[model samples]
Target: MIIDLARFVEKERPYWQELEKALDEIRARLLDLSDLKQSRRVLGLFQRACSDLARVGQANAEPELRNYLETLVARGYSEIHSSQTYVRRFRPLHWFLRTLPRTFRRQMWAFNLSVALTLIGMLVGGILLVADPDGRQVALAPFPHVAHQTPSQRVADEETANNDKQKMLEERKSSFSAQLMANNIGVSIKAMAFGLTWGIGTALLLFYNGVILGAVCLDYMLDGQTVFLLGWLLPHGSFEIPAILIGGQAGFVLARALIGWGTRDGMRTRLRMIVPDLATLIGGVALMLVWAGIIEAFFSQYHAPVLPYWLKITFGSIELVILVAFYWYCGRKTGPEEEAEQ
Candidate 1:
């Protein structure tokens, strides 16, 4: 049964034209990969062309037909590969400035949940400290080293504890940023790691930290040191708090990947899909912690003579607003390309 090659070619020519049109549209940016409908259409066309190319090969097709199909397939391959290459090249920058915030916005539900746990812990700790008298001990128990002292006393005790004031000052001056950054990074790592325990570890860690923060606030308020504490917290916490929340969000994402929710793929396959997002979140958290460490070490700790407490709070507030605005609007475009295609 000899097939009519000329008749088959005539029938398939329209399909080849369609494949070429899809490729051209993609290359010209007329078709957006971000739009699911358009992407599926383009993908389907590519797959169909691949199958046609195989069929043409099997048919001992004319040299002209074979060459055309090969060229079409190559063009499609290049378009796909080049787009991926572009993404790989720009991923770090794109993820940081645009994808991170977009992802953060998407995961606000989880972030809010984490914040709720923290706030609840803070509320409980504050209540215990003010109402129970022994609440200080209970609230501080989570932080073993600081458990012996209230927040109001901790700063003064640290300053006076060392008889070698000069040596203490030297040590702090050299290692302050490093120490603060290490601690913050450690917390983020813990949050992400403990997320594997079905987010229980992450929640508990956040709650515990919140309790400590609340106890400190309560102690300071009771001692009429509210101004001092605000000066201490506001400068670095504006960034640190958000970073911690993002960390918890990463943990939650990991838990979802583990639980096999919203995906039919295997655990490892699902994990691969989300690894890039996790990296972006953790990377942004790292940058925030670095900024926080700088503020905590150099700016927040300076005293009234060098920098007034009110001035510190004012500047910190300004910085906080700038960071918030950056996340809210950065990398977001308002063009037709941004819209989802029907």
Candidate 2:
């Protein structure tokens, strides 16, 4: 090893510099080493540098060379592995705005599957309601408020319940919002937690929710209250529905860990892998439901004049568009930027 210390240093310098650059890029958020290729390459570079450092030490090489190698190898180890789990003080704002979106994109397959299943459930519910009028009773049974009355009847009652309405709104909005948040969050948690059943329970719960949603919409549409239904549901449903679906996404993620189809990792390893993702998804869902619950209690409950259908519908549409943009584009790095990191 001591025979050609100068040549060894020259040969290893490029690799050490490359590893340092990769570390810098990661710190700058330009690259992600969660990818197999990047991790492998980085790990290779780190190991090589470590070997070089050991050889330098054995040969009693220059102190500066040994120290440089030591530092480079340590930084490589930290950055390469840190891609999976950042070790720092918790920053709520950064985690919510950045980490959460990146995690969602990383696990998009589960979310897309969740959406597809819910859509199928909605289609099935709509068809069942149209084919057999007798099934209407069973379909809407879960929501007695809608099940017991025609859409027109409920609309008229809500629009005309003007006796001390402001007083009632002032009194009930806070508590109502709280109740809605608690109930919706409970449902979402159950959706995620039920993944312990190998995703079957999560799927069933999502399907049931989709069925209820579809049935309620069809009931209102058939009864000629489409505007009223949109005014009431869209404002909150836009956020609430997607939030619930994300909960289901988290559940499927849990289920995937249990199944471990593609990866060769063991059960504990697989489970550990998705644990952070589950936490992120569930946390994001909680934030969404908080907004949804507020809208549902204050704005969605009031009919035209107090809160016009057009305004509520427009507001909800805007929220939906922003939400779609958030999940689709937020925290995403461009191909070139990511390449530069590598």
Candidate 3:
């Protein structure tokens, strides 16, 4: 029946129109099939019929054709009742994966903008880190008192020196691993949340973050801590930055949706249809956070000098590969039709 509907919609406008009318009749009949035992079967048929009608409507641009298609949809929706079974046996995760690219395609502009901002943040941060001796202080200006001291001044005060040394050693211990993970997760969330202010908040957050990173790198370089810095930052930064980027991407999506709602008359309806995409983006961000937390807490803080630099590089490369793979899978071109099939 689905195949026939597909063929009709593709090849014959008249049959497509007839199929929509037939679906309306089926939908009305299903509504009257209110017996609880038969609800699932009837609801399934109703949903399939409605979906077929929508496909037919979308494949054609004729006003009359669209009007007829919409009438069938309205008729089907009118008959839906609270007693009808809405649940299906299909796995949500499977459907989410199948539809992800289609969702991403619809928000491609937002996605691209977020990515550009993230890269700018990283680049600015890296350059500042390499060039400025007091970059950390500038980056961390929002914090009180911590950035005031020069590296020499900071290292000279016995009390502060001892405290910092102790803190560093404690961080090296496995027990302090959770703190690192928590810190990274908090940073990512903040970056994402800041994006809601029309990307202004995001820009500021990224700039400040970049400054702090730059300052830290500068301090390390000045102190001849290159090897130690590389060992500490590389493992986790690989996953951490990309995760933050993904969060920024999500923020961009929300901003775009809001803009669309304001500018287009029927945008809310379209947004409702794409709610699943927003859910998927949120899910992806959550997954990235979990991965970042795990890496920071366990692998990055390990003090074992015996762990080869090559191994660290390899792991970092693997993380990048995973990030790329996820984007590719979720942005593939054939996603929409495949999702409808599923």
The numbered model that scores best in TM-score is 2
Pairs in clash, predicted candidate 1: none
Best-fitting candidate, measured by lDDT?
2
Relative to the true structure, candidate 1 has a C-alpha RMSD (angstroms) of 8.0
Q: Candidate 2 lDDT, tens digit per residue, 1-342?
A: 464987887788899888888889877877677678987887898889888888988999889988888888788877765644354447798677777898898999999988988887887778777888766777888888888888999998888887687688879899999999999999999999999899999999999887877888888998999999888988999999999999999999999999987999999999988998999999999999999999999888888767888998999899999998998887776456445745
True-vs-predicted CA distance for residue 275, candidate 2, Å: 0.5
**Pairwise TM-score winner, candidates 2 and 3:** 2
Query: lDDT score, residue 44, model 1?
Result: 80
Residue 20 Cα positional deviation in candidate 3, in Å, after optimal superposition:
28
| C-alpha lDDT of all candidate models, in order | 0.79, 0.87, 0.58
Per-residue CA lDDT of model 3 for 1-342, tens digit only, reads 123444555665554455455445555553344466454654565576567566655665456656766765565565555333332234567545645545555666766766665556656765664566655555557544436755444334522345565567556655455565566667656665665675677666655555566556666566775555566567777767656665566566655555564456465765565455566665655566666667766666543343555576667777778766766675465557555755
Clashes by residue pair, model 2:
none
TM-score of each: 0.67, 0.73, 0.57
Model 3 weakest lDDT span, ten residues long = 81-90
TM-score of 3: 0.57
